[model samples]
Target: MARTPADLLADALRRDAAAPLLTDYDDATGDRVELSGTTLANWVAKTANLLQDEFDVGPGSTVALALPVHWQTAAVLLAAWSCGAAVLDTATEDDGRLAEADVVLAAQDRLAPLEEQEPAELLGLSLHPLGMGMAGYAGPARDFALEVRAHGDFFAPYQPPDPADPGLLAGGVELALGDLVGTAQGLADRLGLRPGDRVLVDAGTAAEAGPVAWLLAPLAAGASLVLCRNPDPARLLQRAAAERVTATLGVQIEGIRELGRPA
Candidate 1:
């Protein structure tokens, strides 16, 4: 048996060294990006190095992220986990709550309010290159792209924490390191999800079965996930058929209800 660590990112990197692990689609621009296991691991490592060297994010540190659903968000989340830092994922754009974080990673639009929070460090990921110029308007905000460019491509992986330590903490909810491994293993066994299987996730941030069902669960199973930005039944069905999705996670919304209907 392989060694189980507190960090899920490290476990994922070790298991699927060269497999394709993340698939992201941008509906606004119709842009699609795919990150193979190796490429994703490298990017996560580089980002982790930047966070550690520049912001001093490491074990026992807490970083808050208010990012949209995108490839960069996944990279940042994994990078934080790789460094053994707890992530605080917040959907609301409250500066007061963001201030409590040691470091804040947010989108450009959300940076202004957080400026007053006086966080230890702030990094903004622009949805597009045009937004980079706006970074100067916000005090102490740095461009995430520029920072990543300055760092070398290599990063020494941080030492893994004990299985009993906290690996992922969301708001007040804490998941033990061992529980995360068990959850991943359980998801794999229950879903019969494999490396090539495609999973469709139709819910957005509002749904109970949102990020965990769509992003984390699929990745944990070494499978690809197709995110449906909106709850359009027709579009959901079209994408499901197009992507040949094997499993789906969503509310009993219109789209999911349609899937359950017999032909």
Candidate 2:
């Protein structure tokens, strides 16, 4: 049976329900949170439902995500993909680009300036645990956590999009849906990825090597991905040793520089 990218993730969630799919660190609070496969799937489904019901974002629609490296951002990306919508990962809030998207997902701090332009509908996702000082904010924005909580755990899966259709568009280049899946599969095969394997991804965003190498590849191979904000040599080594991260994606280094191994 041919598998779509979303299907691959769903399958992994079913097989390894308790496996850690995402681990995010909060530097300010000094807290580490892990979202298991099942929990991640639940959040993705809820977020997808909210997008579908509220914004009418589905097949052929595009959603712009302008957020930092956080768990909510990852959930939104997966949710957009699950809805068969193409995702535009951009940092800057360009009016022209925002005008083209069906919806925009951004942090609460960035919503004010975006609202002034009236480019597109905005949804605020708060990375901070506390909800203080966000009382009067308005303008087509919905709370990420509250919206997800409102939807039921079950979400009707969207039909898989055409493999040749556009999945992501960076700059002026369109990345075919099949190309994304193929790249993910190729990396997984080359890295000997398998079920139950934990892979650490040291990249920044979905537009970078993060999604394809860390997110897509592991999901395609029925494994899990660990996302890190900063890839410090010592921290990475420690996490790899403690978490038993079997595979890593990023720059190649000669020997173990941090470990004092001879080059």
Candidate 3:
């Protein structure tokens, strides 16, 4: 029933702010983080403030992303939408989208190549476990972690994006800001995402499926996420059981049904 990303977030927060909205695990580092709706909203708010105040990003502004699936990536996506900015996934640099982006946010490791392209603005994320700034790297790009934490934990967009304004651009798909929630809701139906469902998603699938399937669909369906990065096959079953995962993506867990499977 939500018309926009902000509306969806507000509805979800009102539904259950104390519930775990996104639970993240990184087998590569043995790290786990659980964020309640309120906590995730706080992060979103801060990032939105950073985008709006510093970069003047709004309706027509395009924010290109070059990062993996992580908790911070969720915040960044939500923040950009909240500020009424269009997000473009920069998986292929030769697409020519990066050349026109108002700002580009990339992982520290991906900065060197992006800098050579000379985008209008570039920000680097270290993807630090503690949310710290880039370490031991001298790059022309601004540090996202160092700047984001200083922003206010609240944001108000200068101009709310119209329903017709572009919201997400990936590959050949383009969606309007107003149609985002609807698209997510439709995907939830196809994926069989149900309210309060604890869904497990692997990093590779999230990357390939894009945000519509991995992130927004879950939120739109009123479900929570158990996102695993660098998943280890040996620990897969144990982790799913521990997380109480009811549905899965990318892995064939016998007891749990795979998302998008025909009933």
Q: On a 0 to 100 scale, what is the lDDT of residue 146 in model 1?
A: 76
What is the alpha-carbon lDDT of model 1 when measured against the actual structure?
0.64
* 148 Cα displacement, candidate 1 (Å): 1.3
> lDDT (CA) for every model shown?
0.64, 0.69, 0.88
Better of 2 and 3 by TM-score: 3
| Candidate 2 runs further than 4 Å off | 129-140, 157-160, 190-195, 203-207, 231-234, 251-263
Find the candidate with the highest lDDT and give its number: 3
Clashing pairs in 1: none
Candidate 3 lDDT over residue span 54-116, tens digit each: 999998999999999999999999999998888998676445678589989998988888888
User: What 10-residue stretch in candidate 2 is worst by lDDT?
Assistant: 253-262
Error of 3 at 6 (Å): 1.6
Scored by TM-score, the top model is 3
Candidate rank order under TM-score: 3, 2, 1
RMSD of each: 4.2, 4.0, 1.4
